[model samples]
Target: MQIKADSVEEYLANVPEERKEAFAKLRKTIVENLPSGFQECLSYGMVGYVIPKSIYPDGYHCDPSLPLPFMSIASQKNFVALYHSGIYADPDLLKWWQQEYPKHVKTKLDMGKSCVRFKNVKHIPYELIAELCEKMTPEDFINIYETNLQKK
Candidate 1:
């Protein structure tokens, strides 16, 4: 699942051929919905969308050297995982997702605070996922991150 690759392309190349198309489609949706100023790259052995250092000089609070992570997509052993930091930090967003996701997809919503696990590609709700991705701009995420850090 967590294939250690140097780049996004390499990560994708290593994914099983049967899973590649689904990953590509999900990646495309993520890219299309991502707000400007976020960079796509490999991070934590997954394809990560991040707020580049230029925008947030401090980078990720957990690791200042790394870019601020906004979202990520990775292939797991049994499921594909989609991570959205906004949903994890924003109660309203999480509530909205919990209420709305099941309406769009018949399957059970396999999700954690930040990660959504998809067992089948067809069961993924791209529209909902895109909507969630578009909920926060890089600036907005930085604001939230900083605020949360201050609280800690």
Candidate 2:
């Protein structure tokens, strides 16, 4: 389900009650573990962590008016989704996460290029998510992002 909210609080307020606590804890894990320089905000209708314009003035390439999005947490119809751009942009990081997921979560990894879907909120691996959040800084993301952009 897509939540159209103006702010993170509004978004959380709108999340289905079934997923609220898990979603909130996931958001907290990210917020507390993410290295300094990323800002929290509502982005693309989800609770997002981004590199503010003050940190990366150019902003996101697709929409320069917005900040550079690094991660997002959303409550979907059947799952809670955690989207991390670092894992998508960096092969080594992606490999690291894939290898690490099973150690923390017994269920098969349910993931897309960047989105990790947790159909069972109780099984969401908060600790692994926290480590993932710490894996990249804003500057590191910008470098990987730009390098990938240049290849396009």
Candidate 3:
């Protein structure tokens, strides 16, 4: 569920009161763990961590006008979502998460290739999310994105 917001602050303000705390904590964790050179902004109606055009002139392959997305967080109608592009691009990361998340989260792990959905705030694995954020620096993500693009 994307909420139209001009900035990260605006995005947070727009989030429902019920989800505020969780979102704030998750946002904090992401910001703290994010590698240098990644900027936080509103992208696709969510809080997005991106590689700015100043560092990666190519921007996103799908949309040159937009910065290259590293990760994103959003409060959905039913759950809060964490999207990590690095985990989606790397099979090893995905596999590791699949194996490790269950040990940490009491609830069933509801996840896709990159998006981890949490129906309850308590179910969110903050440490794992931080690890994912730390694992991919802007330069690494850009290189991976380019390498994948070439294969297509």
Measure candidate 3: CA RMSD: 1.1
Candidate topping lDDT:
2
Steric collisions counted per model: 0, 0, 0
Predicted structure 1: clash tally: 0
Model 1, 1-152: lDDT tens digits are 57879999999998877789999999999999988999999989999999999988988877899999989999989888999999988788889999999899999989988999998988888898889888899988888888888899
Question: Which scores better on TM-score, 2 or 3?
Answer: 2
lDDT of 3 by residue, 1-152 (tens): 66778888888998999889889999999999988999988888888888999999988989999899889999888999999998899888788888989888888889888899999987888898888778878888888889889999
State which candidate has the highest TM-score. 2
How high is each candidate's TM-score?
A: 0.97, 0.98, 0.95
Candidates by lDDT, descending order: 2, 1, 3
Report the error of model 1 at residue 129, Å.
1.1
- Which ranges of candidate 1 are over 4 A from the true structure? none
Tens digits of per-residue lDDT for model 2, 1-152: 79889988899899998888888898889989999999999999889999999999999999999999999988888888999999999999999999999999999999999999999999999999988888898999999999999999
Distance (Å) between predicted and true CA of 68, model 2? 0.7
Model 1 TM-score?
0.97
